[model samples]
Target: MASGTGSTEDRSYTERLTRLGGARWKQVLDVQAPYRWNLRRHLGGRTVLDVGCGIGRNLQHLDPSSVGVDHNAESVGLCREAGLRAITTDELESSEEMIPGRFDALLAAHLLEHLPEGAAADVLRPYLRFLAPGARLVFICPQQRGFRSDATHTVYFDDDLLARTMREIGGEVVDQSSFPFPRAAGPWFTYNEFVTVGRLADRR
Candidate 1:
């Protein structure tokens, strides 16, 4: 859910993302609110790099040292307003002297569905090269119900596809699950997500 300022729809998405975690219903079920405390155990004390971190929703749940990178300037601005650490992907890439090459973990929640087939792989491949050996990479893909709930989503991924993508991109699948609720609840809500965890392979 990175920023894309191409058309009217992308602009609308920015507005929606900015308010996603503010709503009463979204606070209980949205990606940021639900995962805040629950994800701490898995993250341990590592510095996380969150890709496409829109409005810093999930960042609120992560460790204070975590950093977020997004394509949308508005999203990064919103995060800054909330006192969260964030940078545009463009800024990170341009100022190569400032960005870190490695991190303890990487997270992409509700992000991949926006990319086309093979494109998701493309986004993740480079990060794999810089991760600490055996570092963790977690992804949350939408199920059918959640996929249809958003107009921006471009692909669907069940467990099989998620696992396949991880393996193909040089990650070892560690865990896969339907989180916070069952698949049956997906249609009625927007929070249900397919969680997939993978570890970087030993490059040594």
Candidate 2:
């Protein structure tokens, strides 16, 4: 529901990204290969909701029942081609249309930093309503070095800030770590990855 300046431009960029075949697509897959491997190891058999699933790159790592949502129509088409259920929307405008039942797990890789700080919180707020009693939310973003690649990224979070924000948003910080890979280093020295688990408070 949050409006931004570059909807048209974002759609164009997503369209171009969708056309990336051969080596370009391979490069993307290569960059994501390690993360996908890690996710599979940690998140198999869990019903996952992948927000901003670009080109379905993470589909192979998740279970078949997983659902992916993005703002790009082209990306949604590609996800369908890869045999994953996908939905396209303009932005986090309508949670009712995109988010349905409670999910066992949620994945938001490289997505949080793209929105403005307040918008990021808005995007995450609705997901809380749909989570099962003890669902886990896995959030991955560029720690410091990874922030410059896209102009759309509005805010960057380190491990401490990420953990603090997750706790404030009613999720318990269950696990946290740094993602190591060969990439351009940034001020933070490492990209922080977090896995937060949600819990339902027992009635008195």
Best by TM-score: 1
Candidate 1 vs. true structure, TM-score: 0.85
Q: What are the per-residue Cα lDDT tens digits for candidate 2 across 8-88?
A: 235676665555434575776676566767787657788888887877877657988777878777777778887777777
lDDT of 1 by residue, 45-121 (tens): 87788888988878877878788888788888878899988888678766442344467788988788877666888
Clashes of 2: 2
lDDT of each: 0.75, 0.64
The per-prediction CA RMSD against the true structure, in angstroms, equals 3.7, 4.9
Pairs with steric clashes in candidate 1:
none
| TM-score of each predicted structure versus truth | 0.85, 0.75
Worst 10 residues of 1 by lDDT: 1-10
